[model samples]
Target chain A: MKNNHPVDEEPPIEKPPFFNSWKGMYWLVLGNLAFMIALFYIITKIYE
Target chain B: MRPLDWIVLLGTIGFIVIYGIWKTRGSQDIEGYLKGDNSMKWWTIGLSIMATQASAITFLSTPGQAYEDGMRFVQFYFGLPIAMVIISVTVIPIFYKLNVYTAYEFLENRFDLKTRSLAALLFLVQRGLAAGITIYAPAIILSTMLGWSLTITNLVIGVVVIIYTMSGGSKAVSVTQKQQMAVMMGGMIIAGIMVVSYLPDNVGFGDAVAVAGKLGKMNVVDFNWDWKTSWDDRYNFWSGITGGLFLALSYFGTDQSQVARYLGGKSIGESRLGLLFNGLLKIPMQFMILFIGVMVFVFYQFNEPPVFFNEGTKSKLYATEHATELRTLEANYSSIFEEKKQAMQSLVSALKTEDEAAIAIAETKVENLNAAGKEVREEVKALITKAVPNAETKDTDYVFISFVMKYLPAGLVGLLLAVIFAAAMSSVASEMNALASTTVVDIYKRSINPNGSPMHYVNASKVLTIAWGIIAILFATFASMLDNLIQAVNIIGSIFYGTILGIFLVAFYFKRIKGNAVFFAAILAEVVVLYCFYFTEIAFLWFNVIGCVAVIVFGFILQTLIGKNEKELVKV
Candidate 1:
């Protein structure tokens, strides 16, 4: 099927510097957030 | 400020403005003026994005927010990374492919001209006022704290930003932001280190963190899931994820000030990398700023803090009929501070001894003392209100600056002041630049004089930049009426962002919905959001979610009705 969306034809798929793919980069970001939340939770528990 | 501080502040600002003008010289064409000729690399785009969002108020008020409310505010950005990932995948490529000047220009292609104009008008209204507030917020606080004339401070900030922004346009905003971000973060790091160093000799950084943690300043997340109370609560894990996600999507996806940053990028790849960079680093950057505030909180436990953070308001109370009462409150505050110091010392000692039971008891004592300190502070606030009813009584905005003036060494004071001014200029410059591009491209050239020459439109952009700069200055002059500068900016954005985001979402995902239905749905959704804001207890963050949802729901209904009418007309 022909792609109607012009942007989807040759999308920019250059990987970020460290990550192998964009998906990997996104996972790294989400993982970082999860780590931060866990660390904050631990801080809260230790203090409380 | 001392002579050294003045030189540091003025020299740093002078260098940035000149460099911006110099680097972006010869931007004769409209494309170069409006979009930096699509030449910016990812790092420049990233810092510009960060700089445009982190206004002086972020520097001035965020730490104070952390100092007073604890680190839970960091949770507010939990959804930002998610928003970044979504925008990178969806929004950036589309904008890059269209080669549009403003985000609104894409709306015209996707929907219709009126839809584009409506979105542009909404952005102008919010961002225009926000531009002024960016200048006014720091000007008011700095003038009062430093004994400078408020008018001079506002003009210095407004006119400097206007000159470079008008001269070089979008590239100027992007270029100067790199320098501005350096000064901002560097000064903050120095201030953070000084805060820890100023702690009592017996206490270390770990001890201070323990002290802050014990006193509830280390609270970075709250997963409490009570819907009954959650809607009214501003920041929590759930609200941050859901509400914050919506807000970030709207702001980064649709807001031209931000969109313009990456639209100036070299390619879709550069823009996407820039946004992903922001997503990854923004939370840590905010956490660091907030942690600096927590350190300041710990520092105040060892030393004496002012009864009222705003010296101007405190002085006004000193001269009024409530002078004696103010004096008594000051004494009471002093007594509470002494007791709090002793309690903190005991808490520190308990931590040193590693005695869990004693640590718990000491923590309670410190918490009680902190509560008592707050009560005395509230009494002081009441006295200030009684003395100067029209004055801004909220002191959290003043907390970080007050600490800087009192404790930081001489040259660092000037450096930090420069940080505030740089932050203010970086944000205001981006705003004025974005406002000008939208006015000239989306509204003026497109609507009024479609036949104007390229140079004519370019000059029109410059004229509009100056015009919007003036409007922002005038607005800043009258911005003192609002309390809590940072929240005021966000609330104004919230009131408008959801509807804008909804319009874009429908345009992107709902091919069946035509321009007419989505346009009216946007207007109706805005009214409903405003009603919720004025008449309900729904937290400001949720307004983003509500406004977006309302628009989508209304769009589907209106489109179905319109579709049925078209079918009936065919039968007739």
Candidate 2:
């Protein structure tokens, strides 16, 4: 049992593509969610 | 099936299976077998992740859901993108840190072996059954529609998956998924275009969509909730975000089928990127599927749809004493559809006129006819039950496939069928690979044979992959029809998902709760969730929330009491 977990060891840090930090990537996902919800809401109104 | 349709279907599946075998030919060690020796790039992992989740049921039932209920079903996935982000940020990094083979392995280091084993057992119980349903759900549908044997259809899906999955294991599942995803999306896009084009020459794309919207089929987002009534509402913004988030976390973070996808990634960045890709693309993909269903619903408005979609069930009804009654209902349905079709044409014209009053008038007429048609269909379902007591009565699952088989061109029919099979194989292959790796890494290699050579574990995994595939095929072969295919699978998932999610949540975030505490808590939480499922009127999605919260709360209380008792013992 290679017991090295719950280790909280930081992964070898590298810049994610098209983002300076991982934070940017996370925000992009969350932001996209917000935008999609808004866009869907608009579609619902326009259609219904 | 036409000869050309058969050619397209067979040629497509044959090439994918051969490609998967060729690409991942010589996986000699357990790491390469189970994790692809961490050689997968982000894009492959991303497509593989998407393919693994989009089983045949997604293609089959989703459009039907839209046809009957409208596009409000798309709201169910509102939480999934958020879920993808959560996994990418938190779950992926820890997995990379540990270099673990399965998600359960991290539990062993953080908790005790029992906790790890308990989680693994939970996964095996849930995913193993799910793998069977993955094949069975589609096979049963195809069998009834095409007059094929259910057993043969199940083997057709099961054997192909088992072949490639056993050949290269995890790498094979990923390698072939890229092709499967292409086929699934391409076939669906073509189907969507064909459906829209199949509308009468006068009905432009805009008119078709406008007509669908007017008919209340464009419902994509629902944000409102009532405290009393909304608790059991299956699809809404609130439930999707909260319950869907928990379910996705458990699935992607804890479930081996999904964990294996990203675990094969080349590095932390690759894994994270893979998940993010799914997050970005998954919702739109679902929207497209549901929208196609909406377009099909629109298509059926102009062209006369069958009184009953399940022709097989209807044929059985046709033989019974109720045949005359069924014929009468079909006549009524036809009479109502002829009027409804004209009303729909008027509605399209009204929409073109941009006259709100005229549009409202046409909409009411169409709604009335639609209601009349629905009542006739209900009468047909009731008649089916009276005639054939054992046959399945729900026809929504057949809505999309019936359209494809009856209306789409020959080669396109084959391509869409390939979409369904590719989706099934892609998902089944992933599950078999995941099941094998979990059985080997978590149970066999770790506990059963800790000192065995890498090659021995690799061989064991191959055997287990074939074994799981066979078991899935057997289960699919014998499984009876459920009420709704997609919901049946989701219900099974909801039953076990909450407790598994809770355990992983504790392991990942709640450091204070010891392994024993959370282990027992997970068991107790499972009991509570099952109680909710059987005893309460709670919606299935809420089970994810209920089980997760129960584990944390129960673990905390138990941990506190254990800490008190230990202190007293130390003082003595």
Candidate 3:
């Protein structure tokens, strides 16, 4: 059956240079956030 | 400012405006004018999104915030990356698939016309006012500090933004933002470097950081949890992650100004990449800006700092009945500054010695001296209020700019001023573009003239752009009455964003809820949000969470009631 919905037609997903997939890119972003939070926590402790 | 400063400032701003208009000269059709020919790359889109969000107030108020309140303000962005990822995974694909001109247009598809109009109207109200603030924030501060005409400053920013934005529309906004972002970041980075170099010969960067940490200026995170007090604490880890998440999601997902940025991308991938890039870099960019403010705090430790940062207000105090009281406060302030300076030096020396015991004692002394200095500053503020009842005595907004003008070299001063103007113009241009697009697409074309020719809609968009620009300028001219320009913008957004986000979230996720239920629920939710804002001490960020959840709960209840009514009628 042909789906008429444009969303289901899925546009081609180009992989970012460093990440293997969009999911990988998202994980990298989340990882970066975690790292930043940890680093900020350390900075707070060191300075406090 | 010197001749070199004027030349740099004017040359930079002039080049950006002319280049933008020239590059986007042929946007004759509605789609071309409103959506930028759908040709923006990931980097351009990313930078444009960032520039649109980082208004002049962000540049002016954030550093000042750090100077006064420490780096806890950085926590506010902790949820932004999460918001970005979620939007990329869900909202971007849907928006691209629908190919809607405005985010609100998607509401009409998922729900009903009334729902779409309601969300669009909320956005227009919040963003239209925000556009004015974007221009007014820098204008008020710059005019007072530089002794420029306030009217002229407002007109200069509004007119420059209107010209390119009205002429070339969204393409012009996106194209010019690339250059504006470059100038803003470049100017700020240079200012940061110059501030450190201008410090006393003995004070290196490491010493400055240590001194700032000792004085509590380097406080970047706070994990304390007290539910009773949490709602009032503006910038803590908990409020930031939860409330910040809701705010960011609503902002990036439902706000037309942001949706319009990604909507102009060439493809969904490009748009998603653009948003993800912003998520990756925004926090670090904010950290750098706040760190520069901390550097300014350190710079003042050695030098005699102003008792109040706003010199314009200070000059006014000289001619007032309380001038004698002001002089006494100034004398007390000077004495405290000397004591604080000595204590700071003692702390710096202790830090260098690597003796923990000495460092601890010096830290206590420095903190006490700093508190004394703050008490004198408070007295100055009280005297200013007495001298001029209507004056804005919170001078933190003037801290960084005052430092730049009085201390930086002449040409760099001009460049930094250009940075402020560029940030203001970039945000204002995007806002005008988005506001016009929404007014034309979601309101005018969708309802008033569904069959209007493409050319006619294009012209209408241009006219609406001019109209919004003028309205913004008028609003900015009178915006001086508002307190803390940055907070004012955010408070405005918070009041409306939650209800709007709730409506969209229902349409997206709650398939069982019908249009009537969600539309009425959004209205009720907005009223509740406003009630909380005006009556309670709940932090503004929590409004997003509250408003969103209220809509969902209300939607389900309304739907069930309607279902009961229908069943009863059938039995009858």
Alpha-carbon shift of residue B453 in model 2 (angstroms): 1.3
- lDDT string for model 1 (B550-572, tens) is 99999999999999999999999
Q: Any runs in candidate 3 off by more than 4 Å, and if so which?
A: A1-13
State the lDDT of candidate 3 residue by residue for B417-509, as single tens digits: 999999999999989988999999999998999999999999999999999999999999887657788899999999998998899889889
Query: Which CAPRI category fits model 3?
Result: acceptable
Clashing pairs in 3: none
* Candidate No. with top DockQ: 2
What TM-score, to 2 decimal places, does chain A of model 3 have? 0.66
Model 3, C-alpha of B301: deviation from truth (Å): 0.8
Pull out the clashing pairs in model 1: none
Which regions of candidate 2 fall more than 4 Å away from where they truly are?
Answer: A1-13
For all the models shown, what interface RMSD does each have?
10.5, 7.4, 9.5
Candidate 3 whole-model C-alpha lDDT, 0 to 1: 0.90
Model 2 lDDT tens row, A7-32: 32445336677899988988888898
TM-score quality measure for candidate 1: 0.97
Candidate 1, residue B500: lDDT: 93
